[model samples]
Target: MHVPDGFIDAPISAATGVVAAGAIAVSLRGARRELDERTAPLAGLVAAFIFAVQMLNFPVAAGTSGHLLGGALAAILVGPYTGVLCVSVVLLMQGILFADGGLTALGVNITDMAITTTVVAYAVFRGLVKILPRTRRSITAASFTAALLSVPAAALVFTLLYALGGTTDVSLGKVATAMIGVHVLIGIGEAAITALTVGAVIAVRPDLVYGARGLEQRLKLRVNGELVDAQAPLEPATPRTSRRKLWIGGLVASLLLAGFVSFYASSNPDGLEKVAADQGIDQKAKEHASADSPLADYGVRDVDDARLSGGLAGVIGVGVTVVAGSGVFWAVRKRRSTSQAA
Candidate 1:
């Protein structure tokens, strides 16, 4: 959920800002180990894909909708550290450009939505992968379970944060109950989306999916009725061109989703918005600072056609997020190379 301004006080907000910054700093270093020539480029595509899928909010309840949080999906496709950066990029783009999230509350959104989700999801995924069979199906299953739990975990973290620095005097217990209940349902949608997307990628290019790495069983050959390990003779390692193709394909898919398919997303309020409206927690919600931006509210300024306006805004968002995310990841990749050289 994109927490708007005035929901949390200045002190707690600033505290979260520090925490978010520290987390990003740590992730930048950890992502160095996760990113390589094959994964660095895909990391940017994963961010763009998450941005696109988030635009398609699906109905969860009678008046509530949910969208892909992307933490598990990104972590499964790339890695945990990179996943945090991916979601952070999307939240930043939405806040500053689309006015979807508030600028003042950027830290809250990043901490709760990006950091918490990625940590919890990746932890669960690793744990499951350790116990489950090492196969693509097992990886997908683990991804689904991790994604399902991450949403509610994030809701709980937010509720705790609100309890500590809530602007209103609402009952913390009631807020927790409502937030967790609604987000649990929302997590089902998150799991399905995460599983399907991870499954699709694993099917096409398991080599590119970080979570699926080492999950493939070694092939065996029958040599004169004896089973023999299929190991190739020593040869010079070939560069991965298939990964580049996959990255290009993923970027194109993200463009298509945001540019055109986003028009069909459900118009109903999302899980957090619905809970806030019902729980009276949104009483002090402040206007977004970027509300005056031309692309505010996911619509182009002065575009009379609802479809065209929203479509253009979505496309612009995809473009900005990809550029921003790619820049950050590319820098991280460069630092990684420098460190290795040193």
Candidate 2:
């Protein structure tokens, strides 16, 4: 959920801000180990894909909808630290450009949506992967389970945060129940989306998926009296054209989803919004600081046509997010190279 301004007290907001900043600082360093020639570019695509998917909120309940949080999906596709950065980038873009989330509560959104989801999802994913068979199917199954649990974990974190600094008088128990209940259904959708995305990537390029690393154990060959790891058969190197095709295909899919398909997404309020309206948690919610921006609320200001405005904004968002995310990852990759050289 994207917490709005004034929903949380100033003290709690500032505290969460500090926490978010620290998490980002640490992730920046950790991501260095995760980003390589194959993964760095994919990381940016993952972020952009998340942004695009989040725009298409599917109906989860009668009057509530849910979107892909992208934590489990990103962590499964890329790496956990990079997943955190990926979701954080999306939140930042939403807040500043689209006015979807509150500027003052940016830290809360990051803490709940970015840090909490990624940590919990990755932990669950790794645990399940270790216990389950080391097959591609097992990876997909783990992705589904990890994503299924992550949504409720985020809701619980929000409830705890609200209890600490809620600006409204509401029953904490009711809020918790409602939040958890709706998000559980949302979690199903999350699981399906995460599983399908991870499965597709694993099918095409399992090596590109960080969670799928070491999945294929090397065969052993008997040498003399001892068995030793056999050298893998040398295969033709993957062509640069093939890599370019994958990247281009992903970008085109993202554009189509955000620019065209999003127009038909459900109009119902999401889980958090429905709960807030029901539980009075949004009584003191304030307008976003960027509400007056040209691209606020996922539409271009002064654009009368809804479809055109929204489509244009969505396209622009994908473009900007991809550029920004790619820049960050490329810089991290470069820093890693410099350190290795030193």
Q: Which predicted model would earn the best TM-score? A: 2
Candidate 2 residue pairs that clash: none
> For each candidate, what TM-score against the reference?
0.93, 0.94
Q: lDDT of each prediction vs. the true structure?
A: 0.88, 0.91
lDDT of 1 by residue, 99-177 (tens): 8888889999999999999999999999998898666788889999999999999999999999999999898898999
Residue lDDT tens for model 2, 1-342: 788898899999999999999999999999999999889999999999999999999999899999989998988888999999999999999999999889989999999999999999999999988888557888999999999999999999999999999999899999999999999999999999999998877767677889987665457888898999864422223533355677788898999999999999998999999999999888899988999889998899889999999999999999999999999999999999999999
The 10-residue segment of model 1 with minimum total lDDT is 232-241
Candidate 2 global TM-score: 0.94
